[model samples]
Target: MRTIRIPYAELPANARAAVEAHTGPALKADSASEGLNSEIAVRLVSRTGEYYVKGRRASHRWAWTQRREAEVNPFIRGIAPALIARVESAGWDLLIFEAVDGHHADYRPGSPDLPKVVDVIRRLGQLPCPTIELRHAEQRLERYVDRPEDVAYFAGDTLLHTDWNNTNVLVAGDRALVVDWGWATKGAPWLDAAFWVIWLIASGHEPASAEQWAAQVPAWQGATVEGIDAFAVANAHMWDEIGGHDPDSWTARMVDAARRWRDHRKA
Candidate 1:
């Protein structure tokens, strides 16, 4: 659900007071509209330092998503932004994070950001999945998978950031810092790289070119052909189902992009 944008001024005085209690005085709050995970995504400048804050009403159905992000943040410390503060008050939940100085990554072919993104994903693969309950990629794709046996390919103990939407990746200095862990999963090491493959294709790459880029990761290179094929087919089904309902042009484009990649794998 697209939330009505809540400017800092619109928050209840109590909510504003809660922010001040943690961060001194709020000098400025600028709305940062990059992701769908939160209704109040704002950058706040205080006497202490700068912060990024996101929150939603406790009653909102998707508020659990923000709660999930908070639960998963500490485990993936190096891979994402640091969670600085959290507030629970009067039917609202809020998270404050140390702001990173970076911009959204450019995923187009030959962009310098691609290599950094791959490097981040590579390091992510090396970290053992944290000892917390997380959804498996298999469970995530169960409704979409064409073959039940293929689920085995995604069963492993590596952490997965299932969403690679450009906004969720920030390229800062020499690092590509991934953000928003609401959809984080624990799955096979290669599965995360496979997620990036579809995103690379969405960013104006042909399937072959996207595959070439994904091959930079050793886990992806080692992925069985069957494993990658299973993921592609599942993604095609997921995107197709998504597009069939909304049928917006961007969704339509993504559906075709995923289908084109799946067909290439079959061929």
Candidate 2:
């Protein structure tokens, strides 16, 4: 479920003051309507410049995600927005990013944004995993797999942006920038490609077409048949529990797409 949005004006006075110290007085606080993670997501315009701010209460259980995103920003320089500042004040933790001038990538079939997105994935795959604290893919998915041993297939030293939701990818003229690093993981090089396959399927691509797109990523070409099968099965089961059988929810829709791909791989 998405976090309930908190209006910018409602943030504690000290927190607001601390943010303004970096951004100057915000002339406008255009609250963002997309994304599930932040309690406060807004685009701010100030005399100084423009910035994108996302925050959670310091006491919130997920506040560490703000720190996680900040910690990973330096390593993913060209592929993501730069983190300009991070503020922890008066019970709030906020991340201020250089406002990217782009729109979300369209994942539908025939969309021109697809190639740029693949390019982003290609560039991302070339970087080594940073020595930061990141969740390992095998550990994160262990409970979802049929057998614990299957988790080994996902272990590797590559950095992964595991979420491929369309909203998380921004497409400018010829580049696609990935955002929301809170869920960044260390995993097999092919895992991010596999993750993208699910979103492509959800976006109306047939299973075969989606896998073809995944193949465009160099790491994906090395995926083993058994490894792909394990991932498909594990992801399907993961979404089943996350969606709770609610047919109308996005996760339920993902559940269907994942199962379709899993069955296709088996056949």
| Top lDDT model | 2
What's the CA RMSD for each of the models? 1.5, 1.0
- Tens-digit per-residue lDDT, 1-267, candidate 2: 678998899998999899999999999998988896899999999999999999999888888888899999999999999999999999999999999999999988899999998899999999878999999999999998988899999999999999999999999789999999998999999999999999999999999999998998989988898999999999988888877846656777798899999889889
TM-score of 2: 0.98
Clashes of 2: 0
TM-score of 1: 0.95
In model 1, the Cα lDDT at residue 13 comes to 82
Which sections of candidate 2 miss by over 4 Å? Answer: none
Alpha carbon deviation, residue 159, candidate 2 (Å): 0.5
TM-score of each: 0.95, 0.98
Q: Positional deviation of 172 in candidate 2, in angstroms?
A: 1.2
**Candidate lDDT values, in order:** 0.86, 0.92
